[model samples]
Structure formats: C-alpha cells, structure tokens
Target: MTVDHTAPGDLAPHPVDLRAGELAALLARAHNIPADVHRLPSGEPVVSVYYGLVVRIDDTCRFWWVVPASVGRRRPLWTSATVPAVAASRIAGHYRELRARPPGHLIRGGYLTADVLMEHHTASAPI
Candidate 1:
C-alpha cells in the first residue's frame, strides 16, 4: 500500500436516501461484489478489485470502501461522490442506454500519469 503524506479534509457525511429495493438493484447491476470481510495469513485484512469495494449504510452515511489488506492502512480508496439518490431510481435506464457500449469498468485507461496535485486542485494541461 502507498502512503499519502497529506491530511484528509473533513467531508460532510451524507445519509442513505434510496429505498431498499433500489439499493439492491444497483448492487445487482452495477457492482455486485460479495462483502464478507476477511483477513490475510499475517492477520492483515484482504482487499482487491474483486474482493474489495464494500458499500455500507448507517444512519449518517451511505458509503463505499476498499477494505485494506493491512492494519497500517489509515483509509481505503473511495469514490469522490456519495451514492446519489437519483442513481438508484434512474440507473436502470442508464444501464439500458449503456448496453451497446463496452461496460465502463471493463475499459481501462491507456496509460498512467503522475499528476499529483494537492486536494481540491484541478489538473492543468501540459504545454
């Protein structure tokens, strides 16, 4: 795991606003990963593209998380935006439209870049 020396800012938590059925459908269609939290032989937690990406809901927040493979991990990777309410009710329609194209997750970036900016900064085009 890599370390970010930067401190995380306080993000205002959001509540889960979708109905149970809608939430279930999104999990079925978009990202239906099993979420049995498990540990490595060394006693570190396991996290991976297939085994990770756990979505959880509480009274205060509906959040996605990447369970780290080690205890030293301060935080798991996450989406920048909370699960939007409309996504649940409207995502089926979006999925129908996207049926023709390759699934979004199947598409990988052509290459990588080292555009490491501080939090809240935008990446500018190089001259």
Candidate 2:
C-alpha cells in the first residue's frame, strides 16, 4: 500500500505528537533488539531489526511491522530470529494490550485506521 505523504504539519487533521523513531527505540530497547532506524523518502522513520522485517511507526506512535502470518502463528508470538526475544515479547505484549481494548482505543490522528487492520487480516487469510 502506498503511504500518503503530505507535510507532517498538514497531513493529519489533528496534531501528530509521537515520533516514529522514539517509539521504535522504545520498542527496541524494551525488546532488546538493536534498532536500525532510517528515514523514508518522506522522512518517516522505518526501523529494521531483522533482515526481512521492517516496522513503520507513524506520526501517532502506532507501529506496523511486516511478518509472515505463518511465522506470526508460532509460539512466543512475534518472535523472529532477527528480533531479540525480549523485543518480540514486548511487541507481543503491545498487541495483546491493544487487542484487549476496543479498536478505537488504538486510533489516533487518523493513523492506523481499522480499515487497515481489516485489510491486513483479509490479505493474510489463507487462500
């Protein structure tokens, strides 16, 4: 999916207070992964800890990391050889906490909308 790029100040209807790099660092430090933080062409920070994984933390501080659903289904959810176990567990806990609340709890500044989650779910479902 293409990321909508507009001036950070003009993009979101509301102020985006979170820094992607900060969130990524927090997650990485919490999980103990060595975070390789880089800025996208649009200046958004993209953190890569493992070879095949990339996490994009939007302006709102919500995170999205790409991983194979089959790998996701395995034990100690979110574990990857590329990510430290502590980091994986932290990420898993983040999702667990988010899942406990209504979807609205995670929504902020129009980033990571429910539609995105739905689309990811639909796309990842078995054929």
Candidate 3:
C-alpha cells in the first residue's frame, strides 16, 4: 500500500468527530488487536499495548510502538519469538487499513509517518 505524504493540513477533513469509545471499537475491529483505553496525564485517550506500552490516539508522539529486537528471545515471561519482519508487516497493514476508512478529524491529526510505515513494510519483506 502506498501512502500520500503531503502535509497533514493538506488532507481533506473528516466529516465527524470521533469519541474514544468509537475509536477503540474501530481499532479493535480494523486491526484485530485488542487495546486497553485510558486517559493520559494530560487527559487525552491512550491505548495500551503489550509490555506497558501506551499509544495516545490524540498525541502524535506515542502512536507507534517499535517492537524491540529482544522480543525474539524468550525474555522474562514471553514464550514465542517475534520476528521483526512479521511484526512490521502486521503494523504497516493495520495502519493502511485505518487510512482507507472514511476521514476523521482526529485521525487526520494523528496520522502515522510514511517513513515509519514504509520501514515496517520493507523490514517485513522477505530478503
């Protein structure tokens, strides 16, 4: 999937404002990933992933989590090893799916960086 890399302001705006609950439901259904939603210290909604990693939907800074290379090892409690390529493809696909949906104000504001998306795709591809 190719992403248009124009500035965030260039995209057409979303029709509706989405609430946290709505965002949570959309994400769960779209990505098949369960996320625990919470409020940030600044009051923005955040979704927590594995290993205490938190992603704030409202804040652009914390949206993506880079799965560490150590994840390939059985660290502490993790059993299966996570291959970087597999994880990257999964994440890139998820973002692509989200981007295909109807525009949303908050979504436009919290758009993922194209470089990050492409990195995942490239890293995940068979060498």
Superposing all C-alpha atoms, what RMSD in Å does each candidate have to the true structure? 16.0, 14.7, 16.2
lDDT of 1 by residue, 8-105 (tens): 55543232433223455554656552223233343322222221222333334343332222346544333322453443334333334334344442
Compared with the true structure, model 1 gives a TM-score of 0.26
For all predicted structures, in order, the TM-scores are 0.26, 0.39, 0.32
- Give per-residue CA lDDT, model 3, range 1-127, as digits (tens): 9987899889763311133344445556655656565654445554443332233332222133433223364221111113323433454444454444555632343333333332333344222
TM-score ranking, high to low? 2, 3, 1
The most accurate candidate by lDDT is: 2
Q: For model 1, what is the error of residue 85's alpha carbon versus the real structure, in angstroms, after optimal superposition?
A: 6.7
6 in model 2: Cα distance from truth in Å?
Answer: 22
- Stretches of model 3 off by over 4 angstroms after superposition: 1-23, 58-62, 71-127
Clashes of each: 0, 2, 1
Q: How close is candidate 3 to the true structure, as a TM-score?
A: 0.32
When 1 and 3 are scored with TM-score, the better candidate is 3
lDDT of each: 0.32, 0.45, 0.39
